[model samples]
Target chain A: SQTIHQWPATLVQPVGSPLSLECTVEGTSNPNLYWYRQAAGRGLQLLFYSVGIGQISSEVPQNLSASRPQDRQFILSSKKLLLSDSGFYLCAWSVLRSEAFFGQGTRLTVV
Target chain B: DQQVKQNSPSLSVQEGRISILNCDYTNSMFDYFLWYKKYPAEGPTFLISISSIKDKNEDGRFTVFLNKSAKHLSLHIVPSQPGDSAVYFCAARRVYGGSQGNLIFGKGTKLSVKP
Candidate 1:
């Protein structure tokens, strides 16, 4: 069975602070990884997706960025956080043309 | 423009009754549709999916129906229980072409099944 791990579960940071959220999958290799954010009263918005290492496709342009350093390790980062950047961030992994499995999302609060 | 749309923001149902959640998509190229369930502060979980070729797919108490002509899909949960209370999201994807694994999601409908 494959499992995705994301941390920290909840984060509180000041404005203009750096952000780093990590997600990793076990029991699968070369899986497709994605980063999604759900703002208040909104749906999950795709931020970035990677089919392979060092290859990332961004959907919405914002302050956030994603990187797949290892085959199963993906990281979402930001140089400076904005008040609008606060949301529920989720990490998911899937095989080609299949349903995606998600991690326990991170609730980020930028004050 | 939102490719996927869930018109209902919330729904209330009684236990042991039927719960119907609806979704519509504007893109004709989407060939795969899925339903996901989510609780507050948690990630959405894959509940069920139906391909464009098939009109209906059932898994246990959950059933997903797709109407390609109308570009619509729905999720039905019979004998609804309190545990079924959560936000449900509809997602669609174009399986062909270069966007095989990308999924577009809706705003989700909050379902509350009371006992």
Candidate 2:
């Protein structure tokens, strides 16, 4: 079975601190990966998506970026966290033309 | 502008009654639509989907209706139960290539099924 893992489940960082959130998938190859962020009581916003290693498409421009270093590893990073950057970050994977499977999600609080 | 829109931010329904959630889209290229259910603090789960070619699709008590001409879609849950309380999101598949694409999601509606 395919599974996605997102680390740190929760994080609290002061404003201007660096941020790194990791997500990985197992039991699949060359799957499409995506990053989404949801504000409290709001809909999700697409952050970035990657179809293959070293290829990324950013949806909403912001203070964040994504990189797929390996086939199944995707990392979301921010050089300096901002107060507006606090939200729930989710990592998802899917096959061609299929529904996505999501990780548990990480809740980041920028204090 | 947001391609997909869900105007209602929240809804309240009594248990054993019916609950309806609505969504609208602006893109005509969207041929496939889906509904996802998300609990608090958890990732959204796939609930149901309907293709543009089909007017409706149903899974048990859950049904999705698509009105392609109006660019609108809706999800209906009959005999709504307490377990049905969650956030419902509407998504449209954006196909970039033959095998590469992703879904564009609406703002989502929070359903409160009260006992």
Candidate 3:
């Protein structure tokens, strides 16, 4: 069974502080990974996606970026956090099928 | 321009009653559509999906209907339960090269099943 894990389930950082959120998948190899942010729980805005290690794609231009250093590891980072950047961040992975399985997610609050 | 649109911001239905959520898209290239259910403080979960070729697909009490000509789709939940209270999102994807390359999502509709 494959499982997705994210760290620091909740975090609070001051504005202008740096940010790093990590995601990893177990029991799967060579899967497509994605990063998403949700505000008000209405809809998810795609932040980034990785097809393979070292290959990352940005969906919505923002103050954030993604890096996939390992086959199952994806990291979302921001050099300087902004107030608008506060939201629920999610990491998801899928293989062959289009339906995605998401991680527990990280609730980030930029004060 | 929003490719997919879920006009309803929220809905309330009595428990055990039927719940219907509607979605419309403007893109014709979208051949595959999906509906996702999201609970508070949790990531959206894949609920149901329907291909353009098919008009309807069902799993237990959850059913998805697609109308290509109208460029619209909907999710229907029979015997709506309190557990079904959550936000519902509609998404579309254009399939090519044997897979959906990317997906476009719409603003979700919050459903409340009153017990």
Interface RMSD of 2: 1.3
lDDT of 1 by residue, A2-51 (tens): 99999999999999999999999999989999999999888999999999
Residue pairs in candidate 1 whose N, alpha carbon or C atoms collide under 3 angstroms? none
Give a tens-digit lDDT track for model 2, residues B10-111: 999999999999999999988889999999889999999987889999999999999999999999999999999999999998654463668899999999
CA lDDT, every model vs. true structure: 0.95, 0.93, 0.89
Error of 2 at B78 (Å): 0.9
The positional error of residue A81 in candidate 1, measured at the CA in angstroms, is 0.3
- Candidate 1, B1-115: lDDT as tens digits: 9999999999999999999999999999999999999999999999999999999999999999999999999999998999999999999999888774699999999999999
- The digit string of per-residue lDDT tens for model 3 on B35-94 reads 989887787888999888899999999999898889989999999999999999998877
**Leading candidate by DockQ:** 1
Query: How many collisions per candidate?
Result: 0, 0, 0
Q: Candidate 1, TM-score vs. the true structure?
A: 0.98
| Candidate 3: C-alpha lDDT | 0.89
Q: Whose TM-score is greatest here?
A: 1
Worst 10 residues of 3 chain B by lDDT: B95-104
Model 2 per-residue lDDT at B90 = 96
Which number leads on lDDT? Answer: 1
